[model samples]
Target chain A: MNRKLISDQDLVNLYVSGQESALEELVGRHKSKIYTSIYLLVKDSYLAEDIFQDTFIKVINTLKAGKYNEEGKFLPWVLRIAHNLVIDHFRKEKRTPIVTNTDGFDIFEVLGFVEESIEDKMLREQGHNELRRLIQLLPEEQKEVLIMRHYGDLSFKEIADLTNVSINTALGRMRYALNNLRKMMNQKEYSYRQAM
Target chain B: MVQTFTQNDIIKALYHELPASEMVHLEEQLENDTEIQNNFEDLNVLKLKLDSLVLEPSMSVISSILDYSRSYKK
Candidate 1:
């Protein structure tokens, strides 16, 4: 706690110096973002939480084995570890578990036209839930790029390298992702455009 | 609808991938181009919607991870 002003790398150094609480601080700093990133991808809270645990476990093991050389950017590294684990889980299951076309993502479908008089708080929550569902409806690659760039907080270059694609391809995926989401929004007014 | 920058160009602009002059040009053009402006809004809204949905794992999850990591070894 005395080293509150130090960087993640410094925390790592502290942990390396037999201060177990340093690891706790590092995990505390990153747990929310990291958890949300995995949850968005996996779409199953339980599995995402499991992967979250496994990710930090991997981090702990690697660091204990004296392998984490990156300083100051622990979250990205933690995210990379989580991302790969999610990919691996899907591959082993022989299907992308997160891809679903269910109507569960829509407000009208879920809550059936709430009165305009409803509290703004509840309305906002529903709106967020709807958007979250819509995100789940995106195609696998697009959704991956969206989550990595937006939630995982990686740049397109990092996303490109992580997915083994060209930078243009990564950027293109993001572009199409935005387009698809807009079309999904206008689904009632116009048919969705097929991606090229 | 006017076509100003390509979709990739708009993306680059939105995500700050464009260089300074290109970004300035895109902004200037978007000011006069409704089509490009709409496209920018679409992309911006998508990013906003996704960014707004912050999912937190439960406290039980936090406890489990903490316990696991503490006991975990190389």
Candidate 2:
């Protein structure tokens, strides 16, 4: 999946040349990742959906108005815009809504059912639920790093630059995140074994 | 220094983010240290566990974003 085939720079050129499909392609390529990032943070399907739209609308206007420079990095730039908007949404609402875990909606659970081995699939699903629960318990810094690295597919260096931290610091947060999750899982397993 | 490594160190090594010298040293230790190797395996399992938890956005969200973007046509 060479999703980068249509480079951001090329997309910008196409948009500037009045190629509307170019804009559509750019949005199509990145909509999922962008929406996921927003959704993770805001935890509201409707609001996250709104911000996702607004992010691209802002992108379109910026590009059309000769404001978007071809800086060779599009996703992060757009993400930053989306991030800021989400922050604004929280500010206007004056209260951050609690993120409810919708039933039968987790992508991993759906993927788990597709696995051939029922026992292995069950283990994977259990581990995933435990991990998700553990992640919510993580400190803000660690949670952000895990989300960006795993979900957003950003490199540690990119994440460091985005979050204004040293690469080692970013790496360290991810380290802590995994370590904490492992400990949590172990503790959970011990309890389950004792019960059994 | 007896070169004590923590769970975090194991994760850094797993992600290939450790400094080259530290990575080399860790690799050498893993070759000879069963405990460290076990920790590495545990970290791998932990990472897979974490990776599996990502939920896909709803289909309505996807369609809404596309529709929202299209509404800006001048």
Model 2 clashing-pair count:
0
The positional error of residue A155 in candidate 2, measured at the CA in angstroms, is 3.0
lDDT of candidate 1 over A151-188, digit per residue (tens): 77787888999999998999999988888888877882
Clash number for each model = 0, 0
A-chain TM-score, model 1: 0.81
How accurate locally is residue A26 in candidate 2, as Cα lDDT from 0 to 100? 80
Model 1: residues with Cα > 4 Å off, grouped in runs? A1-5, A98-118, A188-196, B1-5, B69-74
Tell me the deviation in Å of residue B45 in model 1.
2.8
Q: Write the per-residue lDDT of candidate 1 for residues B11-42, one digit (tens) a residue.
A: 87777778897787788898988987987887
Best by TM-score: 1
